[model samples]
Target: MFVQNIRNICVVGAGQMGHQIGMLCALGGYETVIVDVNEDALKKADTLLQSIMEKWVTKGKISEDAKDAAFSRLQFKTDLEDAATNADLVIEAVVEKLDVKRELFAKLDKITPSHAILVSNSSTIVNSLIADVTNRADKVCNMHFFYPPLVMDCVEVVMSDKTSDETAQTTMNVCKQIGRTGVLLRKEISGFIANRILGALQREAVHLYESGIADYKDIDVICRKALNHPIGPFELMDLSGIDVGYFVMQQRYAETGDPQDKPAACIEEKVKAGHLGRKTGKGFYDYAKEGVKN
Candidate 1:
């Protein structure tokens, strides 16, 4: 019933997660509008999404006709008000800054219809922090999707104390409709589930690298070859953007004032240099070369 109510979906921020997530919703038969403040970002998202859909079609993951239908259902815009005014569900996939999200949520509350459910794609910060800025806290929740939403199957559906059951169930239903698995978290927690575990592993990996025990490349090789993990921590970081992890650490440290939660020196260096992983073409490993090695 809740799922049936969501027909027009608006995805805010056209960045790494937003574009692909909008594609998922469109593919799920929802009328999806992906909005971004920057025109260039929206243009880039359009090109990238087309390339992704083409790859999917070539790989037999989706048919060419299905791709055309998904694109037909998807639209891109630079104006938030125009994109979200009639939306039944709005997914905020902007930067990981708390103040930025709080401001956006407040604006969305005013722009969207009363029944619209607003969900954040934040990987670390819980929706509880952002929900308070809006009048309809009950309608705000976290729908955290992994990097490259088109590929990742799992989404963390986290609810704040004020979130209604209908909102959560509706989000989960949307996940199923988009062909992704949604794990519901009854309560809000920083980093949700996957990131909490991944954070711990990343912290240790950074520690091992900083401690001069081994090179980051060597550590990645060991994790992949020995532990049988598909991708190592460092490689995953590179793929997901080093600045993203840095921002998450900064947010965590600000929340807890934990010295341990501060961004590692290596991450800080990379972020400062603007080498923010796959998007920027240089991160833990340089992707400019033939093999994408450091």
Candidate 2:
């Protein structure tokens, strides 16, 4: 089915990405449902969305009427089956675990309509691994969004060998509809395009920091000043969450079994200490006294 024909979207897992994605869909005039098993996460998503809307209003980005219209189209649900019952598209944005994603898609396969497309928002885990779990392999692929989905305009529409061409194109169209630049990856890779580049930069950044040549703060400043990067490697990790960086690296390591693919010790240590950045507060730069080092 064409993306224009899709009216209802179900975004499973109301974490940082899922909720903003649903809001984007709603803003694009689609009936969107953000679902999560955890009630607290759902509540958090609701609060976050409200803050986003208010910020947009203050910035004159979205009119109050338009905000209300989008708000009307957005729905929050706890049940996957109920949220996906009549959805034309299902975007899974849970934790970045292959096994966890496989299990969810296995259940979603039975729940979603036959025509509905099932996509994953995995940062590194390719859809091919999770697509096999579902009966609709032809309709499944990866639709990865960057950190802070609401602000990031770029999205990756990735296709595996089993994915149909129509599915990939339709997903790309859906990205445009939601005001995102959809970069199509005809071939499936672990991190697709953006994250692969990001991973390479991060790997070297960690190597530079861990080698004791420079502190993380100096490294961040040098990158921003030299490379013209909007955010430094360490700051981006903090913004995206140290735990998320660790998991993505861990997943890539699991897939490639490469020593360099393993997450840096600093990332692992930060995650273990519950310093998950902005969410829990401290990461590379302390956010205890000042929140969100922007």
TM-score per candidate: 0.97, 0.98
Q: How many clashes (backbone atoms < 3 Å, residues ≥3 apart in a chain or on different chains) does model 2 have?
A: 0
Q: Assess candidate 1 and give its TM-score to the true structure.
A: 0.97
Model 1: worst 10 consecutive residues (lDDT sum): 285-294
C-alpha root-mean-square deviation, each candidate: 1.7, 1.3
Q: Candidate 2 has which clashing residue pairs, if any? A: none
Q: Write the per-residue lDDT of candidate 2 for residues 1-294, one digit (tens) a residue.
A: 897789999999998789999999999999999999998999989988998899999999999999999999999989888999999999999998888999999999998889999999999898899998888899999999987889899999999999999999999999999999999888888888888898899999899999998999999999999999998999888888888889888899999999999988888999999988877778888888876532
- Please write out the lDDT profile of model 1 over residues 58-86, one tens digit for every residue: 99999999999999999999999999999
Model 2, runs deviating above 4 Å: 292-294
Clashes of each: 0, 0
